[model samples]
Target: MISLSKSIRWLFCLLLTLAAAFPAPAISAAAAEPLALGSSEFYYLAGHMEVLKDPSRSMDFKKALEAYGRGEFLPLPGTLNAGYGRNAYWIHFTLKRGVAFPEKSMLSLSPSYTNSVKVYVQRQGRSPLLPSSFSPVLLGSDVPVAERPVLNPNFVIPLDLQADEPVEVFVRVYSKGSISLTGQVATYGSLRNSTYYSIMIQFGYLGIAAVLCVMNLIFFFAIRDRLLLYLVLYVFTVLVNNLAVSGMSTLLFPNHAHLISDYMVYMGIGAQVLVFSEFSYHLFHDFAGLWLLRYIRFMSVVGVLTIISVSLGFYASVVPFALIGIIILITMLLLTSKKLLVSMPQSGIFITVAFGISMLGYFFQIFRLIGIIPLEPGWEINMVEPATLVHMVLISIALSERFRITERQLADASRLSEKRAVEIAEDMTGELRENKERLEVALAAEHLSAERQNQFLTMLSHEYRTPLAIIQGNLDILAINSENGGEEESQELQKMRRAVARLVDVMDVSLMQNRMLDLQVVGTSTIICADEFIRQQVDAVRWMWPERSFTLHSELVEESVFGEAPLLNTALFNILDNAQKYSPCDTAIEIRTWADGDFVMISVSNGIAGISIGDSESLFDKYRRGACSHDTSGAGVGLWLVRKIIEEHGGTVKMNSAAHGRISVGLAIPVERGETPYCQKK
Candidate 1:
């Protein structure tokens, strides 16, 4: 049994040796010598190179080189791209330097999405070393940037060669993303120009995408349209994905480049799919079936979840989600287009064209990444290059076309409305003209009536005053006669005379106010001391109503005022009279005068219980009276006259009532142009 077991083990060992001795062919080899590096500065590498597949991914540099010496390598089919594969690829090439070529050359591997890249060179004196052994020169995403032969966003390898010396080069590449080993060997100047244009194209795409994003965002807000909003999101995701896939994000997030580069593909794909789904939903919403919409929403949610999963390092799940999402999206678009073709034919046609253009570009890029299509060396094209710009332009065109249609509809409606308005105006024109003629006749009659009324009032005022003067004469005679009779008779006579005097005063003041309103009696103003003028008015009130007790208080800082003294005196007297008439006979009426900034204020307060006043503004209206004035025997025009006179002096009047049923009337008058007085406030 032991001998049999040993024979079996020896057979297994021999089989392994045979497998190692004859590796499977990957591609065919080129018969010509490798392209020489020269002053031309650039050489397409794939067509002139051979490639080997390291299925174990454990094949060290030394073994790979040994395999190369045995002619085991296969020529690169066209370009090296093995999309999302576990196996690492080794590309083999030889370079002979011309006398015109520089001593050093740069090799730039394209498409920065690869996770790891390593280059091995066999120069005139050195032997190839294993990758496990430390190499003074190494370059890849896994290698620290400081350890790289040349620092670059892409994997850059530096070569030192002598004139006419043949040098062997090998590059190993592997990635979770699509493995693309496309590169160029050139002089610094050629490489620099190539890099400049490549960078320009990359940044140009990003710049235009950024601009579209902003524009679409603005369109969303300006037009209040959700389609533009989705467009903005789509543009943003595409920009981020392009930045990640194109390897330009390393420029922005250098320290965190590995993190960005590793996960951004999944993130970008998930986000792009989700945003595109949303955009399509909004774009074709009119024709979207319920199930189709539900499917879209489901896929969108899944895409979002996939993005979360990817961020958490479940990158392997992205492919399934993406595939499912693509299927669902295509079905949705087709169903929507079919339904829209029958319902809204023009819009459906527009959508179909735009979608076709966009999908063409999308598929072109996807196929290129997956190695389904060969990439021509030195000829670079981004999937978004033709796709995104055309998509945006077409969508914008559709939107503009819709806007134009809407405008035409609105214009037709407006024209119809204008025509109807013209007809209505024509129908109403005669009625309006007739109304204007009638208004003119009515105004003329009103003017004549007002004139007659004014003349009658003037005549009445003269006649009334004549009779009141005669009645006052008769009352005086009767009082004299009653003085000799009895106390009751004299008191009756005094009451009769007081009533007559009050009626005459009311009539005179009313007529005077009428004259003031009619512009017949304009009172001229003169600078007068407000404190002295108010005191004189208070003294007159005391002399007239001796039985009614009153107190006058003055706080004069700037007492001079520009107003008619007689009018101001009359205003003050009317307020005092009203205060006395409304208050109980025993209650004293308090009149106070003070100076506020730039004005003199006269306040008359009385403890008139049950006097309920509402809005102070309405109280100043002509003929308006306080609620408590029902039993009072005076015309309600007293406060109104006071307000009118004060307002004429460019001042204001306000009325307020306190908690104790104390009503106060405050009158403000502008101070005259003069020096302020020394005040002894009381």
Candidate 2:
């Protein structure tokens, strides 16, 4: 048993000796090849470097060097992108001078937000055994700008190299934000030129951003539009975030460079997302009541929380949230703006272009941060700055378009209102015209009815006149026959004759009135001297009232009036009859004729009893009578017929009531001037 155990121990010892003779395969890998500095302006060190993730963050410079010597560090195939974490990363690369390399060189590391960066350089020929051979430089946001070895916004380490000698560079970085590294080895002259170019570009971007901010700010004040204010704030946030990302904040605010680099960058990102979302909300006012608005509001809250978390020093935790919120917000805005295209074409197109550009920029940046797109040399400036500028311009145009659209909508509404009012007015006018036409038709029908009634009355009067004449003839014969009978019979027969005579007179008056009522055109008219006409009418009245006293006065200037002879004679007879009937049996009726200007005047004066002054004019109305005529036997249409007939002859008739119960009726007719006469239907 002792001999067997001895053999096993010898075998284990032999295996241990063989394992110690060769290093592990991991350590057997070849070291990174040294890059020779050439006449090129700058050299990218990412692909040429080795990386080691120090999760414990306890590894010092010596340990990093030891690990690199053992080839434990892995070669980085591309840019260093150790996403958001509290981890530390160690990067190592060897740089050698070429035939035309400059004596002075610099190692630049980006971005500036790294919490701590320590660089250790050891000349290859002398650095393996002695710690003193290594030169150390400190840089990062944690290190004050003034205290850094090289005064630069980003971490810059100056290198002293000997001719034909290679030097090893080791960088240890720890960050509380997204950990990304892009290193460049440049000569002094090249670095200066690159820095000047970067400064010029940055300043140009800043100038554009400032102009946009100020312009939108002015627009906000001028128009009192909150969308412009939100746009201004969004643009300002973009400027701040971009400055922080590019490390220009260090130069702008030297005292608070660390704060800007660490917290404000994330905060600015959150603020940009918040403000841009608000701008979108207001920009898409037509969609304010849509269900998508709720999602936008939710994203806005996320942006606000991101800002709050970053302010509370949870920058690394909130960075991804802020970036995600921006993506969601931009995507929502793009889709929403596209939807608006149909309703608001100009505004929608402009905003869509703006958001599309912004989205492209953010995608590039996010992809780079997440290591999806590797960072290359000479590609230091991301598309974000240019995209932001274009975005701001297009967004401004979109806002102006929205304003124009709003104004157009208001104008359209006003025009619509006016059109509606006009339509209503036209409707009312049309209704009034219809009513007026109806009223005209009714008036015409009433006038036709009056004419028909006048024609029927004329026929009835003619019929009654024939019968009354027959009765009068019969009464006359009876009176003659009864003259030989009893005195009572003779008296009765005389009464009957008087009654028949009164009926015949009434029939005559009725016939004349109806003729006047239906008179539209006279068949013929003749001129008559006013003096002769008045004298003839007065003689007829004196013959009718043989017992009554009558007088005629004439002061004519040979004036003749054109009229129908029978109508004029009837009008004069009615006036005379009225005067004789209304006056006392003992009073004398006076008739006068005179010529005045182009008219002939006929006047009849009579003594009236129980006639009020107010009732004088009403006597000319048909069926009108005076209080004193209640006991008299006469139709009341005599004066009305007189007035109608006189008016048809282009004349006027008026009654004047004088003191002492006296009334005078006057007729004025225009003298003939050898012109044709026309008449109108009543």
Candidate 3:
């Protein structure tokens, strides 16, 4: 049997060889013309390495190379900074000054290392290097790189270094290539024939890591669910897997290697357990389906046991950590089983099944690692891509729920706020503005009454004298006739009677108009339906104006219209009487009624000889009659009173004059289409 050191070395060499055989970029051929010994100055590649050389151009590099005398290590420029893979060593060199290196590959390992190890070389502090960046031109003879590599002792990597100019080198050894610790290869942890397999696994891990990162971000936006806490853990798990599989964890974070290797396996397993705990908590509600929690507790206990196993020595330490993770994926399945029990709805059942399968995949992964489950290309490594993907999916589901709920809440809040704002505006305008306007109107009305009183007294001084004079004349006649007693006395008495009657009628009309205009309503806490009350006025007017021709009409009123019937009556009579006096004799006066959903419309038409139609608008003003109203016998306050009545009833009046010289008055009042109008308050 071989010695221990020799066997271990063989195992290492075998692993490196297999790793080098893994899939990676093929090495490129040297340029058509070799670089000469003395050529260019310096070349660079960003943040990695840079080199300068002299007499660096050559065809056969073996002759021109001023290689180090054997038995000495080559020094290369390097850094210990965190960004440059902290605490790592590299080989940096320069040809004699004034030379440039071209088309040089500092180190090239067997393709197997594409998975188990990675080699990146570039001129430091410059942009990225491409294949065709520079080429060598020969100015010197051959070199000694053709000898079989001596570092091929299984564990040692045989590095091929060549360049037209002196170049720097960096080498990395992957700790994840867990080949057999013996010289001979085996099935489960083989040292040969699986080099390419390891590299592909690493590449797969990177792809998975990228996917996990993308999915986590998406979920974060969508669900914002507390479950994302578990997703974060899963993302870490993915990162750890990538580093371990790529061997980067060992090269860049050597302090974390062993821990990271085991962490990949354990965290991948532990994430499932945590996920199950969270799922069970969310799915079955309370602690109702708590057997899984107990299982998790048991697994955690085992994990601690596994950690202690480490102190027992490397041989016995692999069990607990691995076992805890694989104990039961069915816990997730069971968590879902309860959901599938029909009491649960199927809204998210697809997600449940998918996650359940993911849990199984985790179990399969862990089982495969410890030699329990068998699958093609078997063996768990520093990578957990599938597990990462599953975790990502779960995270996505949670985020979707969060986003959907948030969107709905925002929409609802927006609608409610908008509605409230509208209501507030209506209240301000309808209540406050209306009340302020009413107060201003009240003050205005008081001022108007004072002005009207002054005008009334002034007009009375002029008008009363004529009637009093006529009365005085009539009284004188009566006195004379009574004294004469016997001649033409009857005829004279009859004529006097006629004059007195005309005077009395005018006074009565004026008094009634005054009561309607200046009457003070103690309160309006009353309900007087226009339909009922208007009929009373219609009948009274038809009787009083027996000689006046007018056709009165009323239409269907779905609801009660509010108004003070008595005041309306006086107002209507004045309008009618005025119409009678000015209208051509024997012309029919028409009264018509109609109501829209919100307003009651009443139009009174008369064939009266009046002012021109152009002056109709002025008729509604107090003491302002249309020019067509000339020669009418009455105060112009008649139509003005119509406007006042309509205003008090929360309505408007419009006058329409026909081309034929007839005039019509139309009134519109705000009346409810249904329900009784609010009784007016006194």
Candidate 4:
């Protein structure tokens, strides 16, 4: 008996060890309560669903059944978000029909971009072990519309449920992109209505995109803006992507449904990234050295590589790249918009709002894609389309604003150019008028010279004074009108005033030359006090040049000269004027008058320090000016006339160079005796 007990204990210990090594398959927990299909039009199945991931992508119906019995399927509320991978998902749910439930209903899965979907339905009391007990339905983007269990954009399976009887449903989904799934059970009528609404919404978005594309193309042709061209291409890629994601491409090209579903969707993503990067680069080209541009260029390269990968049938590999590209895109948009807002407020407002909407939509989608926001049935109404629609509209408005601003700047420049042209024309007109007056005076002088010399001189003086008065009057009016003008205008007015002064000086020189041409004294001589005459001339010249200094030294003893008063006045005035013109402004002019034994002596002296001196006698010749006189305005006839008039009055004129580069001109006239009436003849 002891040996038998010891043997039993050893056997039991061996049995316990075997049981630890290989335990029995665990019985799955009771399935969640079946959902009751009532009078409601639609029911969300996510809350009542269970999900199991098949990473190997080789799980069949038999394996799925065995796994469900062992409770390998986990309860999934809301929806399934199996991120980017080549993974398959199995979803299980049970539904019971209430008294008011429809006999025939539809089981729908979204967002309709899934590559493959298979639905299996098993009626109550059906044998769980027999494959024939479960009816299978094939649907998805990869399945042709005609081959699908129902004619709908999304995957739909028809279900016929018995009253108060529970029906078991299982769905298998596989995708090369993000694997996000949500489902609903609805009456056939409800499913039809919902599907039609969804199609209408998607088509409406496409129509808006098409319209925007056409409008931007027209703008591009009209304005030749490259930014608009990039925008058009970007929008076109988005439209193509929408068509693929919305299942319209599969219906339109039924024979190539697999190609459209597999390649076109990812290709569209890459193409959009490429084109949008170009658009952004051009839009912010003004900021040439921005760091964001480098990143955008990198994204463009990634986009191209993604397209290449998709073309090479690396669909699964391209998905992660696409997600990374999207994240970069969102980052670029936000950062660029912020920069634009600070740089250009008017246009930036529209751009910021547009990018903000787009970013929000993309953020929501990406969060759902990465399982941050659980997928819900409401996700079927994609925010991207609506947000993109508003975004595109705002961006178009921004482009329009830029166009308007450019036009306004151009118009302002044109107006400024026209104003300048008018001012130049007015100046030319004034010059022509002055020249016409000068020509008339010359013609009149020629005609009168043949008749009488004095008559010609009279006409010359009158005609010259008339034009001078007119010019001075106009200049005064212009100066008053431009009192509040800019500095440039004020400077222009000063130039005109100087030109008028120069014209008056030329007239004076011409008249003096004509008077000296006769060389015959026509007026009677008069007794004039030398000191008084010199003082009067000095006072007159001081008024003309208020800024110059003049010093006078007189030691005359009641001495008088017999000569024409006008002729003597002209000679003294010419001497003083020459001194003022050649000397620097800050220097002083010295005039001396003294009585000598047989004549009254007069001298005018001024500093000509840096002037190049030639023969001083040649300065008395007509039209002979000093070397330093280039910057001063003169016809060089003043000293010649002075010499002639002094000689006619029985006086001698001599030029003398004094110390320190001072130049002096001396005039010695015979004093009058017994009041003899002298007719100074040349």
Q: TM-score: which candidate is best?
A: 1
Give per-model TM-scores: 0.60, 0.56, 0.32, 0.58
lDDT of 3 by residue, 1-682 (tens): 2233453465457435534553222222321121132332221221132221212222122221223122122221221111101122222223221223223222222211121222233343322233222222111001111222212212222212233333333233222112111011122222223445655655566666667656665665665655555555546555654554444444444444444454553343444344444444454343233555454555545545544443453322445344434334343343435444354334255455555666555544444333333222223242235654664565466456545656788999999999999999998889988899999999899889867886785587458757767886877777688778865556556555544544443443344435446644442424556565555555555655678777878883544666555455556666666667767878888888776768777777887576555667877777887666556566678777777766777888787875466788777877754456543322
Give model 1's TM-score versus the native structure.
0.60
**Per-residue lDDT of candidate 1, residues 1-682 (tens digit):** 1232343465457435544553332455454358677767677776777778898999877788778778788887566866555688888777788988888778788777777787767666554434343233455554555555655667777777788877777788787656777787788887777667777888988898898889878877988888888888888888887776776776677677676665576678788788888888777666666666776787788778768866575555365546435543653474356656565565566666767676567655655555555666854567666677767766766676766777788999999999999999988998899999999999999989978887888898889889888988988777777776763455556556756655655565556436446523665767787777777667767767889888988877446887666567667878888888878888888888877888888888888653556655686777777777788776667778788778878988888885567889888898887653532333
| Candidate 2 wrong stretches, greater than 4 Å | 1-30, 123-125, 288-291, 311-313, 411-682
Q: Global lDDT for candidate 1? A: 0.71
Model 2 per-residue lDDT at 621: 91
**Which of candidates 1 and 2 reaches a greater lDDT?**
2
Superposed model 3: Cα runs more than 4 Å off: 1-197, 214-224, 241-347, 369-371, 374-384, 394-398, 405-409, 420-682
Q: Which sequence of candidate numbers ranks them by lDDT, best first?
A: 4, 2, 1, 3
Clashing pairs in 1: 27-74, 27-75, 28-75, 41-186
| lDDT of each residue in 1-682, candidate 2, tens digit only | 1232353465457435544552232322445677788878688886677789898999988788778667688877666776777679998888888878787889889888777888888854685535566788888887777788776767888877777788877888887777878888898988888788887888889889999899889989989988889988988998888787777888888877875575667777778778877777777667544545665677688778878876587767767756755665665566566667777787888878888899878866765665555666656676788888999999888888788888899999999999999999999999999999999999999989977887888788878878787887887677667666744456556556655654554555455544555666544778776667677667666656789888987887556788777678778988888888778888888887877888888888888864555788998998898877888876787888899889998999999975567889999999876632332111
1 or 4, greater by TM-score:
1
Global CA lDDT of candidate 3, please? Answer: 0.47
- Writing each residue's lDDT as its tens digit, candidate 4 over 138-254 gives 877767677876666777788888999888888898876778788889998898898778778888899999999999999999999999999889888888888888877755676
- Flag regions of model 4 displaced more than 4 Å: 1-30, 123-125, 250-258, 421-682
lDDT of 4: 0.77
Q: Find the number of clashing residue pairs for candidate 1.
A: 4
Which of the predicted structures, 1 or 3, would earn the higher TM-score when compared with the native? Answer: 1
